[model samples]
Target: MAPVPKTMSGILIEEVGGPEVLQWKTDLPVPELKDGEILVKNEFIGINYIDTYLRTGLYKAPLPLITGREAAGYVVASSSPDFKEGDRVTYLADHSYAEFTAVPDVSAVIVPDDFSTEQAAAALLQGLTALTLIREAAGIKQQLGISQGPFVLVHAAAGGTGLLLVQILAVNGAKVIGTASTPEKLALTKENGAAWVINSKEEDVTARVKEITSGNGVDVIFDGVGKATFDANFDIIARKGTVISFGNASGAVGPVDLFKLTPKNAKLVRPTLFNYITTKEERRAFTEELFELISSGKVKLRIHDVYPLKDVARAHQDLEGRKTTGKLLLKV
Candidate 1:
């Protein structure tokens, strides 16, 4: 085993505010390992929208909290026999924006031999998110219902989870339509297997979607942009369509009227990843599917950018400002 560093660096939020609230310090102690836990010497940390919500206080946390959710690293110490020193692992959990992390053994998954640390860091959260939304949330069962052909519309098509979801749907033989803000993003969406791409900023999304589906709308819509696109999202669904409202990147969505769904006989559901993988059994099942997808090349991990761990504030600013197109990571 390599000698572990005595102290580690981390990003801290002093108060809930703008990007200015992010502070970095070098003197923090490495997280102490607990029973059933392993200490990881983090090599890369994932930058996600949830991290931004935590920093801005939109999602409340204990004041003066370390902020980060996903990271990939080598195990340095452990109380559990499942992981040994020098094993490569990754996890999606809070408090990972540091040089070292003490994570429960169950929460961490060993990276496959084919994947690098960077890919492991970028894939865990978004890949799992995509898996849950498709298999669990939207319920893509053994056979897709629509003989006319099943269509899935994904908002924020160029994002991490969106890209993965598009591929997953495509491999499952669904006609996938995606919405993005720029031509570049639209092209990326197409590269990721979207059958159709709509520039939601410049194009009338509802009109384009209707035109693409020949006025029938789609069978399922995976919406994460929230308030900014919810109305248009609602307008584009077919009768008996299913809408899965997952994340709020633009802002919180409506206090929706259940009556609205009655007119179209549609179903409205709000799903979080936590609910989908509620039990240990469910977690294993979902993750196994996700790993199989990646290992089999049915899904590809898109890494948009990588920055030093100390550049967490810049990463947050880029993501919140909508300046990035795919997954972002911090190289520790």
Candidate 2:
């Protein structure tokens, strides 16, 4: 093995506050590789709203932690048989804010020959999240099932995962109703496949969805905006509809009253993406389907912004401020 570096530059959150809490440091040691782990020299890191949750203590993390969950890079050293030096891969791991990360080989996906590291970093985690929503949450397992033309509602329609959801649902024959705040976002959502785009700021989502669905209500509702959109989401949901609240960008959706599921008997599932793909096989299924969509051009991602790794705090600020539309990245 080539000489391992003893230190690297990365952001560390010593205290949980606002974006200002993020601290940059150069003397932090490159994490030691453990059994079954491969060390990657990261070239691109994904910036997610979840990272802001971790940074601001909305979600608990070990204090004084490197905070990030996705990146793409080349393997530098490995103790595992699955990877070798110079293999291009996308890594889904904790503490991915650094220039170098020691990650489990099972948690990494080999980047396709056609993709750049930045592309992999931008799509892997968000795409997997979108896949799980449609496949498991929406209960559209087979092609024929989707051809039935289910009604689907996607909140934050122009978001990184929302755009993919719209395209996937549209490609699978679902009638999509997407909600966004700005004209640009609404237009993007409409172009991607939304049958209707509701300006949540200027219009009532439940009313517009009811008008479009003929009062039957949508069969599937995907809400990543959490508290800000929960009441509207539940209001517009159909009988026995499947609803998933996977993120808390606006604020955490507090405890649910089971009574809320009463009249309609709808299903509400609050899930964490990382927990769903713990095994290698589970990971493979998500990546395989996601890569298939990307390779065939059924889905695409836009790079909203690229900041140097040290500019991570600014990335978080933009994310929390809702100043971005597509995927955000940190160039390492």
Candidate 3:
């Protein structure tokens, strides 16, 4: 193997404030690969909304932290037998806003020849989250007493995970109601199998859902837009329905009175990503399922914009402003 570099450039969160806080520096040292760890030369890094939370102090992280959740690349060095030099892989790891990163061997998956490096990076974090959201969190099939299809409502339906959720639901025969703010996004949702799309800005979510479902309400709601959509969930959810509160893109959801759900006969669930894919076995299963879906053409990925690593601040700016669509990536 070639000699490892002494320094690398990355976007650092010196002190959280806004996109302006992401300081790009060339003096950051390349991390050392320890036992059971692999060093990756990143080719593609994904920008998720959660990264914005950390940057804006909505979610706290240690000072001077590198701010990327996932990336794909070739293994440059390894200390574990499970991976070798030059193996193409992708992982959900901390400190990925750089040219190279070190992650525990257990955290990465080998990229199959059929899968490109960009595809792997784009799919890991969001793809698995989508899989669990549909098959586990919502449990629509079990709740509706059917395997083929169930009624579902998804907020921010044009998002990376939202788009995948809609695709997965459509493939499994589920009828979905997606909410987006604009006509373009709503059109994308419709193309992806959303039977009805709600322009949350222009229309009342509850009223539209009632008109579409004919007053019975939806079987489940996968909500990531916290405060803006939380109240509407209770208004539209069916009796015994499940609300998966997975994210807070609009704003953090405030205090809730549990009694509110009692009237609707519904329940709220917040499924954490770490809890779902904790073990290597679980991660492998998710990767296998996700990869199979993509390889077989059952799923597709949309690359919104590929920003250069040096332009991370603008990437953060655009992502935070909600000016971009689908998956936003940083070319490492």
Candidate 4:
């Protein structure tokens, strides 16, 4: 093990704005561990759309915030019995874009021996999100009631969570349709097990979806694009189809008419990872399933880029510019 630094470098966002607000500082104090906390020397940090939201003021947090939500590393010190020095772990928690981070032992998941730190960090958050959506939110069953075949639509198909969602839905025997903006992204989505890939920019999404399903439409649409894709999603779902709108990458989805549900007997649900894994039991189940999937090679991490900790602002810029095809990371 390398000698722990007394002061660590981190990306600090003093105000919510554009990428310019993310300032890298090298002299920040190494966060001290509280009781039941473990100090991890972060090897890789996950960059996500939610991080972009926080940077752009779409998702508000305290000003002058240390702005990272996921990472993987080895425990350097521990005040918790569950973890000890040198145990490799990954977590979806705040303030992860640093050389060292203190996280509650309960919040950290032990990475399998064969998994690299970078792979663990890249996969954990998105994998867990996919698990919650497929197993809990959508209530995917052995046989979906009233639906002849399970068909699902996933928006932002090239993204971290979206790619995992594609694989998970496919493994559950659902015909998965994924949407992406470019040919490269579409190829990536297809490689991840999507049965169909729609170019949201070129195709008339609803018409294509109708044509694909022979006009019956799909059983479920997992939309994270919010305003830009919601209407098309509504148009293409089969009667009583469930629309799971989980994010707002385009912009915040403001309001909708309750009567919209009455016409087709359709339903809409807004689910967050926080809600699905709220309890320890639920969190444990979710992680265990995800770990099994990854270990068995049923799912793989789509890590598109890894930047040094000092270049976090550039990572955020790439994320905001929509240049990334999959999960981005910060090497700490």
lDDT of 4: 0.86
lDDT of each: 0.86, 0.88, 0.87, 0.86
**lDDT measured at residue 241 in model 4 versus the true structure, 0 to 100:** 90
The residue-by-residue lDDT of candidate 3 on 1-332, one tens digit each, is 78789999888888989788888889899999899999999999999988989888899888989988899999999999999999999999998999999999988989999888988888889888889888778764323422346678989999888999988888777888999989999999888878889998899889989898889888889998898889878888998888889999889999988987997789899897768889999888878988998899888988888999989989888876767768989998
Model 2 C-alpha lDDT per residue in residues 86-173, reported as the tens digit of each score: 8999978989999799999889989999888899999988989988888877776545644478899999989998998898888888
Q: How do the residues 204-291 of candidate 1 rate in per-residue lDDT, one tens digit apiece?
A: 8999999999999998999988899887766899999999988889988858877778768989888888777777687778777888
- TM-score of each model, in listed order: 0.95, 0.97, 0.96, 0.95
Off by over 4 Å in 4: 1-3, 142-149
Residue 124 of model 2: what lDDT? 86
lDDT of 1 at 290: 83
Q: What is the lDDT of residue 88 in candidate 1?
A: 96
Which residue segments of model 3 deviate by more than 4 Å?
141-148
In model 3, how many backbone clashes occur?
0
Supply candidate 2's per-residue lDDT for 60. Answer: 93
| Top-TM-score candidate index | 2
